[model samples]
Target: MATDDEDKVLLAVCDVIKGSTLLKAGRSGKPHFRQFKLSNDLSRLMWESAKKMDAAVLISQITEIKTGQVTPVFLKNPIPQCEAVSFSLLYSDRSLDIVCKDKKEFDTWTTALKALIVDKYDNKEAVSAKLVEMRGSIVSEDRLEVQLGTIKTKVLLKDNSCDLYLWGGGDRGRLGHKDDKPRFLPNVVESLLGQNVTMIACGGSHTIALNSKGQVFSWGAGPQGCLGHGNLRDRYSPLMIDGPLRDVNVVHVACYENHSAVISEDGNLYTWGKAGPFLGYMDDSVTKQTKPRLVDALYGTRIVQVACGRSHTLVIDEEGRVYSFGINKFGELGQGHDKAITKPTMVPNLVSICKVSCGRHHSAAIDEDGVLFMWGWGARGQLGQGEPKSLFSPTPVNGFNDQPLEDVSCGYGHTAAITANGVAYCWGDNASSQCGVPSSVYGELSSPRGIVLPSGIRPTQINCGANFTVLVTSIGQLFTWGCNMSGQLGNGEAKKTFSQPMPVESLSEKRVKMVACGEDHIGCLVGHGWVPDEEVKSCMACKKSFTAIRRRHHCRQCGGIFCGSCSTKRYPLLDKGHADPVRVCDKCYVSLSSSSNIK
Candidate 1:
């Protein structure tokens, strides 16, 4: 009797091959073998006659078959100089001899015939039921959750789970765990262990979380009333922000520098914290809004998306019209003026917009035609317009006109976009390697250039932090480049930079669904099957033993284990995802510095 595993293999092979093959025409008076192809449903096999040609055989019409038949061969030496397995396929009207390359091939054909016989008369319904069960099981394993923080720390939150994990910097209650102690490894937020948190966002020194019920929670530095609790008080633990927003079903939230914004399901937008002219209010009477307040100017317009810059805000309505209100020191508002706009004013000449992104001092947008528009600070070429001059109004990025972008993102001083074909393009500051290019080529890219990756690696999503970039591929693989000062790349290293995209090996086993970045930290959502690595006891490069004094360190560039002595060098690495100088091992230092030709 065949084992269950063998039976499964046979069933799979039969389902894919289905016994379709080339057969010589005997009674049809043709010298050529006719090719038969299976229909998509596998119910029938169609073939063309050798002369007039066009015939088909239905699997349901196949009768009993005999194997190893040598008498009454259809053609003499069907395959020249090769041994072939012959069998008789009995149909309702006639019998035909089928020749195969070998016994293995003959067995495959026989197995498919047997399966079709059984399926046609005995187990068709049973097999269909089993397939449905298998499909359900596969779908159950697909749910995933991803979270990201800044260079100072990291966070991880899984879907359908209530626990929020935090690591790295814990200053000013940014970790949301009621303490200021940094966590070198992931630690659960005991307070939110069963709260069923759904989303998380991080800023310079603050954290915000949204639960399944749309309730908003915030913590950390509130110097500018970023907490949205109606006061400039810092909370060491997660505190629910309730009041006007309590009854609203908030769907999305974003944070920048000392400001925060939330959008409700009904298309309403609320903002708080560091309320200068940037929060859509021009009144000098209010410089800070400790509580979430509705933008009166956008009272009737339904906002579909919102993004925040350091001191500015951008909103898109249901009609694809863009509105900007905030500081315009570098023309970030794209309003043809350098002065601040106290109201949500329409960004002129921008229509059919589909997506928008904001950097610390610049903004980017993509339209229905896949055209990219950029404005604001361009000193480092973040605008991608072939120059470092700032734009006071929305200007089309002509370089990408031929590329047809699908998505675009902006970093503090760089910009990245993905074309419809999944190719990634980046431009702007290479000072810290943020542009994924060498500074020796050009300190800043005045125009967009392609970012090369290994074959078969196609980016599905891209995001930029203060100085680093993160990408997630179609197969759920995560890659990071630019600066790595705070281990934001999640590569387990602390190298100064990576001039190219490198896989985050720690997440090799886990299916990463989402990733977010901050100035010094990263957060990711992954499937439930992830396994943590054991602690390293030796340097990955020199094999030096690690002691209490000789602590274990990680190379930011390669994400390898290293000792303090082996990882003591620091370099201004923008490509490894850092905005400043970061410590790296000697190997990475030499490679990164030599590539850029910086002594």
Candidate 2:
């Protein structure tokens, strides 16, 4: 319960002198200056209270006094009158005159007024708390980790305590906790409560986490050695991987559909799981990497970054050289041939690369010169070449030759980039509004188009999920658009899609330092003081009590708390990038089913 007085606290103050006046046009069409006297309190002045002359207003509410002028009056006597500075403050339907003894006083008063306005109105306790929370959240310099499986999950790491939190579907132990128990709110992974987990990556049915000591741990589905435990065995809890990577200090990890890759502190790369002919293997003789194996071909190359597509792997070396392996069905290998490579091979015609990104079947890279090169599948215009033609080799993206790009990201069928000038651009598939285009024109965008954002908003980093895009601005503001069926946009809504970028209001109180998007989930690392949603004791849809056997569930479509009975149905939420069946509440199921029929 807040009172109006609490909300209308003193926001600003100014020092002033007598005999100075502010002039503005009156209703009679005549310009006039009102005289006033200064009180003992520098913040206060003596004026007609009946005219609401003492009403306090925020500095932002003050309109610029462009037409009004301030005048100082001097006495023509034997002794010259002291000089005075005059300024004007305009409010809605009213104007104010402020006079200071000298120029120094005027400047001091203006600064004080502006500073107090921000301190009193913008610096609320709630905002401060959120900032504190964001600072403690786990995040890379500009990348926030978010994942979407049947459920949405995020990881938060503190100084010495790493906690894995999950909500939504909990099937197959994907949540890394009790099996079959879905969570509606964030629930900590008890096994990793005390460990210093620094990084986390997710596959279709598995999860992998890395700690500060360079130790790797994994859980969930293990078929095809996706869990990297030296055997295709699933673990309900976190298990430290102690195979060939035990002696090495792992710094980064990436997980695809059925395989994983890790980078060590020494810039060495290790890959394992689901090895097949399409993944650069000469034959299908070996289909599973039960243990981590070194990439022999990259022995002399020091890799700095790694990205994984649905079935292929891309790595960048210290010298900005690109190396790729795996399937080339859609030219994802960028090897000038549609044939798959069985080993790590240098990508021809690409060098000085600073960043690399992989999509479901396409690949993109940014060179030192800020040029963006893309290749592979382009049926949806992902190549940004003004046509839907697949390429076996890297091709420079058109239309950005003069504007250097700072960063770029690739989604399932689209591409996004941020220019050095802080403009955001997107191209390719917009079927789900992923390209930030209107839904009525939900087709391919052959060339990059600047994403219209609110005035003054400048994007610094950008990332794309399967069918959605998230970006952060230099001011720490986050904007999200595209599929919102799973609340991945973090607007706390279940709308099917957003055709334009919208601010994430839920994080307005805190500063968003990093953001990561997965197939259907989004994670954010904010500054301190964020309070997570409370765990509901009863189902949100049916309002049923929870018991020992009656487990809780979450609607992937709406992010609502529910009971198993209320969320028993499953559907392919295309807008959320779930092409396979995923859990949905009865309400969403009914709405989606009806909409499908209408379409």
Candidate 3:
């Protein structure tokens, strides 16, 4: 039931001490019982249904818990005091009303759930204090009070903020530095030193950043007005998008190719740039937008997340319903038919979807039950269907039904996912090793393959570039592999490709919070600050003198360097210190394929 993502510490309670069966109260009141279970990581509560009605909700999604006496479920079908017990799990827009067998069962469920709010969060400190004895009535609106007792302790968690960094191809200012210069290693976006950037998104060449104040900033190539500045000019530094978005409080942002979209705290969606029909415009006259405009067609529904593909856009609301729009020539919109929809339209069949991702032409989604569903382009096997056929509608991607996944990512033509146990599975186009597997061994990965990462550190987040992939671990370190022709790998070298995840040694001291990748550039939001490793003199491995021809190389195995060679030919006696992959070499030859023993 727990996701293998170790950094989150979600599975504080691993074992299901109580039975999985629970009675769920329905609005219509017919089938009042269902099989219920909790994911191992304590991230979600799932309803195990044999049919298509299976549903789930993240434990973090639950806003509050209320005792049965105060909920409307008891008023609709009042249960006598001698009959049973009930408690309602309230969300932002709905409530999950359930009935328990007895007070013991009620106490067990309530205590375990309350523990999540306190223990699951990172950097938490529990404080014990006595509750004020109340003989009188309490506000029932947002209260959780069981007959057994009131709360005795509370946990206060620290909030961490990340500073922004950028590197790789700096063409047209895509890297956001004041000067358009290709940074081979991690470089701080000095202008945004105090921006407190919470999220970032990358397009074909431009980039977008979201700060804690909910304001939006963008920079890079603005041709077709992709920068949202009301002009088609490129910028060499981060520029805040004001105008129409000045007063809007954006909570999330997504961009791809030549377009961008942002969702406000109120669940309203806004879009800009050359998105065509995917902008949620009702008419064909709206070819592109220079400034942010609200998608009026989706006025009533609350959109929580948005993803943009090459030819389509995907979104999911608070109700777990999926929607698609834009060009559907390759069925990238997830619509049953291969026709483009000019506005927001719900994708038929998918329900309780918690997350979604988009590649150049394909798309991926995860439902509440931790089930993966894919659609759109599959010609290169990005859909993980074990075939190259395109799926016009949403279809379940079978593999991790038992150990549910908490997150997934889509590269230009490849896909990757992380399981409940923190293991990474990848598939799709591998011509450039974008799938994290050896391209020579498997030119095309149709089915998902679990990749082995360095022991100890588990993957917390992952992202895909056009021909590369980057992963962030719980301890704030980063690993990048695949095409580095434009230095997108951030390993201090260009024109190299690696199948195994290699550490970006330059930023080892920075706790990487998130990574954003464009077709050629890369951006990272890291917690706090760090300095690059000190410059080395003689090669630590060979203890050789300074010379131009004997170019120094760092070993990937030992942080000494990114071992210049992904080979096992055995060089001169090795060096142990961190440097550019000198003769000591990269010890990190771990492969994504489980059966391989190549060093």
Candidate 4:
């Protein structure tokens, strides 16, 4: 994966603008070390760049940093009014600019900005060493402790008196619980006690995690060996995936279908999963593996980000080139045809993809400008294409052509996105109300449409399940709608699905930072105000479904009338009042009964 010399390097470098000296440097090619430093004033650079480009003045201001606190520094002069002003930042470059009204404003901000600079420089040595160590390790688990995605895993940390929240499905622990007994609430995993965990991911059934120490651990299903454990056994607990990948620190990890990918501090990519061409699984005969292996094909490419679909994988190189591989059954891989690739193939016509998400059958990418592009399955409107016909290549979603999309996520048959201003929109099949908006359209939409939430609530993140939707707000509130079967919606009922978003009462007062959805179960990561009790929330419908219970541990799955904790106290299913009652798992309950539909 050697790129031409012209390819620009990308790395996440914190750019600090303070007083006289604005310094920027990050892990370059070698071991973690400060390789580049810039001493010029950011304000002067901004004005010069704007003037040279024939652009109007656009004042740029940032709060001053004093004693590790951010303080606003107001300018005596007003900001320049211009037709357009743009701001851009690259991971490695750290160069910045602002074209604004006058020198007075710049000077005033500069004075305030100076104090922050001195503070940053004073702290640079310690932070730099930490950054280098991060850049050197192959899988930096510490950075992942508190990640967010569609499905979230929460393990309580008694030491910190807080719960560790992780999102994204990297393993079968899709419920986001440390274990898999159909957890409905975020609880302490016990196994992860004492150690501070920040993030977790599930791919297919496999799970990967990062700790406060910057280490990565993985477990669960290893189909195609996505667990990176170097074995195919279903790990009931978390285990470290591998050692330092190279002289790099892993900053992010993404899981799709059965493949896993990670981004390092220096913007390098390392992946392990299906043995395909682009995935670098050299064992031509072995399609899957049980351990994490380096993707030699991507060496030196400086990958900034990655994503996975059900059977395909995506990598965004620093130079904005997208590489794709794996199954292209529906042309979801974006490789120009339904040709399955064994190696990494450059995705056609995709550049500056700031974010990417893959559904069960399709894929979506958001560019740097916030315009969303979708491809793959259009059936049930998962692609938002306004038609049932599937797409073989990337197509721009029309409704947001003018407005920039802040983020986008896809489900089995739907898609949702948030705009830059915080408006959430959805399109495609509303069956089970997964779309969050009412759409009689049975299939997909060619344009994006808005999804209404309870008024005055703007969601910061969203996740989609088989036929349901979950939203978490900046204020730590949780809302859900759509298919409520099995109490997945956590409303203490087995009612029909909703066509619009509704708050989940059981999780009220629980500041939910993340949410994860399984095919039927759901899990959320709580922040502040969540009750720690494990009281059973009964689903009256489930109660009626139960006919008998032969074993202990709640029989919600078996339609048993007793809660798990109460199952042992009952005389099984022998009661005369329950004569001829039937027993089955919770999943079977959906098949045995029908209830009145609630709007």
Candidate 5:
């Protein structure tokens, strides 16, 4: 008969492994007296239970026989001759016995014991029931990562390769890489590694990038000190600007010409960049600030958003208060006075402002009650007010009779918006067919016109570039319209312009995460192509034109451009070259011949 400890192992291991292996002994006595062997370490109580409880009576009343010569009836394996085993007695805490066991038997017993403990301790349903109770609690230590823009279709192409489409690469530092170079293909931008970015916006040559952390990074032309770096120096990399910004986290940022504005988490407004009399409170001492300055006039009240025009700013507060400031030369401020405001000033009777967007020379806003408002230069009906020319203050654009607005975006001289369900509409100058309205359908639209999309295309997000419009679909497709010069559409070719949205070719696989547009350049974040490889290419940092010409025989050392006669030393790194159409001067050729072999 097996001891109590051996009985437990057989109970657990036999059930778990399901008879894969076994331990049995030949009986030597009628009582099946097989010499019991326990592991080197067994609970004293267990051994004592077996020894003192009439299972075995010993001279010392020892519970377990330690290093003892127990006569073996049946041994699982050859027992170790010298190892000691601790023993305990039943109903006693002070006495113990030693019994020896084989090393293999010891290991098997240990495994079985652990399985038995787990079976005894775990209650499956009880754990599941407790987890369900915690699900209702809302306080989460982790925050949700949200983004605003959709991916561009032409951001990546087939074969897992990159083709960066870069234009306006000269000025705003928009390329985010080396300047003084024109990048024709959409190349990989390696600076955003490990960063979770949500939105990107560009104004002329300046750019503003917002990450999930609520921190804003900007670069590009800063002459108007539009970069907010506090100084006028141009920035090549995205750098954070210091300000009074905090928990009232920033959600959206916009820049126009040389000015920038941002909407905070709490809906307060902040403006910086060129400040003129039209901003209100006109005074020589306080007009302009290169850094961000809070619009204290609307501080206490929550303002939903702000938009910037070429020289003016428009803000709509939570209670539907429309505020206008800055250059009103075209009467875009809409204060009804035809004068610019140097500080925040309320626009007379504006109410229920749901959304507001600005163009190069005009401003448009929609009320919560679904009424469209227009002011300033309405040239070619960008104001959707039926007539061209200026409207000094807030005037309702006739046609929306009673339709509510969901969102809005402004272009250089036009505007576009989407309804709650997915219908897109546009008004304003369709000069490059950016409005998606047929070119033959001329003149300004006094009312909103529907944009016809391809049969199955539904836009997830929409963006307006200088004179173009980009639409991103929920299924990761990108379609673009308007001026395609410089291949801004990423279709591998440039067109004078397109009248309707056209699908970008070959990209249905790469997942584009985000896109940003400058005056003539486009930036996008693409996935899955950062693998490493080695290839010899021209250095972006050096002048390629200077190294194009070669010398047949020049000193390999010092790069003196002298013949072999003058070169005493041979340096192969700089000396190796090809002999092309023209023969190199003997003096220059001989200079490179010394020490280095002509290849």
Candidate 6:
């Protein structure tokens, strides 16, 4: 991502700075100058003199990179009495302020520190890239990788043997049937049979798919070659993406309205389509990458995941740090400034962001601790901050102290989330009844409200689309509400709108493992060549409801849904047409234990 000279400067940031003053409130500490060195592996930042090791903080321990004096000590001492070019390092519990010798040195130290936090770039590249510092006056830089709402596929599901299904608007070749006819119900994509497709991303008009072999396929109406077929022509059948993606194992793919990107298993990122700055391209001559091209700027970084809004894109690295690029007019980048940039700039102050979702303008991310944060456009209260106000930085959604959220989805103007306990909440624009609330309830919600679901409808995954919502239960049931203009609800209707959650009866026959939402279309991935999730709706013996945490188990012997208590034992049954654990049910466990043929 940087030249050798810049890498050296970033790796060799040896400096002495005036420290102190900026501790937590009610703490006492004196200011002093100390020499500091970044560890060779760039894992730790250590400071000391010739005699003693003052302190050593893991680079990952620093939660935020801040600028200027902000502590009570600095309030009393004032900037006139201290170094004006100073920055602060905020950890989980404490903060350390360091003052540099001059403006150049201050920029160098701050840039190096921010880049090292994301584990990329150096001071010069950071400056050129415009770092995302929290301070209002300071600028931020970028490293590019982005995921779109089209493919905000969570990693919670690892099963890859899934069949592809599609419904809704077939215009622009979205249904992948080589025709522009609408599918009013869930129908299997016969062409994708036996492909073992693991994931699917439904974009505004195009669709991208990835199979178990790491092959990526795309079709539908592509803007600026988003389909990656070397031209802007729309495709009706899934075509394996080649060009720069040829022979590359694409682990992840994201698509919004007009752009698309993918992360290779080897940690390399490739992007196509049209996103002026958000596309993370260094070249200024090319307006659109008609073919998928490797993003040279973020070449070596390990991007774990990505999400994209209408025009902006956010990428998360292996360290769980957040980075953003593209348009920031509404502060979707969470860089504390609205200026758009072309590189992947670190989103400061956010720690261990594990999941991210992008709406038409807003963005949401969940930390490892399960706290949900929202930023960007909030004119419709999509930020869920109890008010319609845009946030330049990531802000935690209140009222979730007890139960953390496990899944989140952002739509054109609405948002949805699922708690760890299976509770679903919706907030933001309800004008089209997309917020899971009837139009009588209000045009928009300022805060999240529990969605009134039908009996036995506990959601394990929640997804939002242009003007509709999709929820998947533990048993593979799918319920939809809001806009059905294109028969996206999969209920054999095209002109109706739903204010309450309605089951897509056509999908009740199979087990839905994953779902993707496009502007007016839908894509589903179901468990293939196995017992459908629908068959395991309840425990065969107890008949209890299944939730996100209280999962339904399958009996290895009879293949019936059983509670954990019923299938507590595992026994080999290779002789009975099974290889691994053939008899796990209570009866099978007891019988296998008594059988001398168990060998």
Task: Give the per-residue lDDT digits (tens) of candidate 4, residues 364-466.
Answer: 8888888788888787666766566688889888675477887777777778888877778777667676776544543344456777767688788877766
Predicted structure 4, TM vs. truth:
0.59
Compare candidates 3 and 6 on lDDT and give the better one. 6
lDDT winner between candidates 1 and 5: 1
Query: How do all models score by TM-score?
Result: 0.60, 0.58, 0.64, 0.59, 0.57, 0.63
What does candidate 3 score in Cα RMSD to the true structure? 20.2
Evaluated at residue 232, the lDDT of candidate 3 is 86
Shift in Å, residue 157, candidate 3 = 7.8
Which should have the higher TM-score, number 3 or number 5?
3
> Tens digit of lDDT per residue, candidate 3, span 41-108?
45777875545575888888888877664556556755433123567788867878765533444555
Backbone clashes per model, in order?
45, 19, 27, 60, 41, 15
Per-residue lDDT tens digits of candidate 5, residues 197-259? 556667777777675446677777877877877877777666766665534468778777768
- The full ranking of all candidates by lDDT, starting with the best, is 6, 3, 1, 2, 5, 4
Per-residue lDDT tens digits for candidate 1, residues 458-518, read 8888888788888889987888888776666666656687778888775676566666565
Instruction: Report RMSD (Å) for each prediction in the order shown.
Output: 20.6, 21.8, 20.2, 19.5, 22.6, 20.4
Highest-scoring model, lDDT: 6
Model 3, residue 8: displacement in angstroms? 30
Evaluated at residue 373, the lDDT of candidate 5 is 75
Q: Judging by TM-score, tell me the better candidate of 4 and 5.
A: 4
Determine the backbone clash count of candidate 3.
Answer: 27
Between candidates 1 and 2, the one scoring higher on lDDT is 1
Cα lDDT of model 6 by residue, 1-599, tens digit: 66766644533343211121111212343333344556544567776433565667887888787777785555554333223465678887777666543344565677667776655533443433332231342312221221222322111122465888899998888788778899998877755654668888888888899986678999898656788888888898888887777678788888888788888876788878874787888556677678888877787788989787778888889989888888899999999999987888889998898999999889999999889999999999988999999999999997554688999999998899999888999999998899877777689998998888887778999899998999999999999999888999999988867888988897777789999999999998987654447745676556677777667776554445567866787753322222223436675566445432211
Q: Which stretches in model 1 have alpha-carbon errors above 4 Å? A: 1-169, 177-198, 528-599
lDDT of 2 at 16: 26
